[model samples]
Target: MFRRTFWFTSGVAAGVWATTKVNRKLKQLTPESLAAAAANKAVEAGHRLKDRAVGFALDVRANMAQREAELEDALGLHADPELPPARRHAAIENRNKPKSYVIDRTTHTHNRNEDH
Candidate 1:
């Protein structure tokens, strides 16, 4: 009689466990849950693809810059860009000469080209 009672209790516990597990699995199989899972996976894939594309673009930019530097070096076009270009427009002696100005009392004006 004791063995019969123990077997009955065990059978009920097993059935309850199986029922709960099956219900949980059924909930996961519903359409809304499946759609949410798929959307989450797609978003993850999109993020990975975007990261790869960004890395590829960065690599291409670096290569382009390296190639440009190589071409500039090969063509002998590299020069310092910070210094101002020298333009010798005036003679060396004329640069230091001062202009004379004469103030005339008749007109109350200063003439630059008149002899003092």
Candidate 2:
């Protein structure tokens, strides 16, 4: 029984010594040091994000210019033919069509009634 008690006490002492060493090493890894490392990583990430955003903006501009050129080319192929002088003269007469209106007092009265 005495030998067992001695072995247990020695084991407890060794454990306490090991724990102290581990605690000392952990203390070296301070919150301030950890926070600075985190800040540096964040700054690097932000720089990468800014670079990606600029690249995307440049790509969008390139695509837009290509799309515009394609549309202009398509429109050129379907150009309208010039109208003959007689047809042009007759078309001008059609533009002077008489305009007429019926007084919509009923609609106005209905709108007012709905408002009330």
Candidate 3:
């Protein structure tokens, strides 16, 4: 008789526990709960996209810098740090100096003469 009573009590407790668990799971599966979960996932994906974009931009900048350096090396245009300041100034001045030319309209010729 005692064994029969104990088994019945145990079965009732187990049924109650299972019902509570199933109810909680059903509540979580409601429309509002599902929408909230989907919104959270979308926000997480946006953050990941932003991070990837930043990484891509940084990589492009680095590659451009490397390419510019290579171009300078190929053209032999790297400035010498040890070059004298006076020579550098003279070279800049020569590059910027304008020239005077005399054109003979009748002869259709160009001549560089100080008198002209």
Candidate 4:
């Protein structure tokens, strides 16, 4: 009799546990829960992609600097860190100039008989 009762209690516990687990799984498989899970996965994938892109950019930057050094060494070029005179002058002039935001939309009519 005691063995039968013990077995009945075990069966009831197992059924309750299975029912709770199935209900939880069903909730998780609902549309809203599934959508939320998909969105979370997408965000995680986006973050991973962004991190990889940034790493690639940094590697490219480092390689570029290394190649520049190698080329400069090969050319036996040793010069000041500043830009050359002409470019330096142009840069200064550009910096001092006020930026114009106006866009020109006027179309000029060209003479058809200007050259043969």
lDDT of residue 79 for candidate 2: 38
Q: Looking at candidate 4, what is the lDDT of residue 95?
A: 48
Better of 1 and 3 by TM-score: 1
Model 4 is weakest, by summed lDDT over 10 consecutive residues, at 85-94
lDDT of 3 by residue, 1-116 (tens): 99999999999999999999999999999999999999999999999999999999999999997997899899998867898533323344455545555455898756676467
lDDT computed for candidate 4:
0.86
TM-score of 2: 0.42
TM-score of each: 0.60, 0.42, 0.59, 0.69
Model 2 C-alpha lDDT per residue in residues 1-116, reported as the tens digit of each score:
99999999999999999999999878758898788878999999999999999999999999997997799688874334584333323344454555644456766565545654
Query: How many pairs collide in each candidate, listed in order?
Result: 0, 0, 0, 0
| Candidate 1 Cα outliers beyond 4 Å, as residue runs | 81-116
**Best-to-worst TM-score order:** 4, 1, 3, 2
Tens-digit per-residue lDDT, 1-116, candidate 1: 99999999999999999999999999999999999999999999999999999999999999998997899899997857896754558655555545555455797857798899
Error of 4 at 89 (Å): 12
Model 2: per-residue Cα lDDT at residue 20: 100
- The candidate that achieves the highest TM-score relative to the unseen native structure: 4
Cα error, candidate 1, residue 23 (Å): 0.9
What TM-score would candidate 1 get against the native?
Answer: 0.60
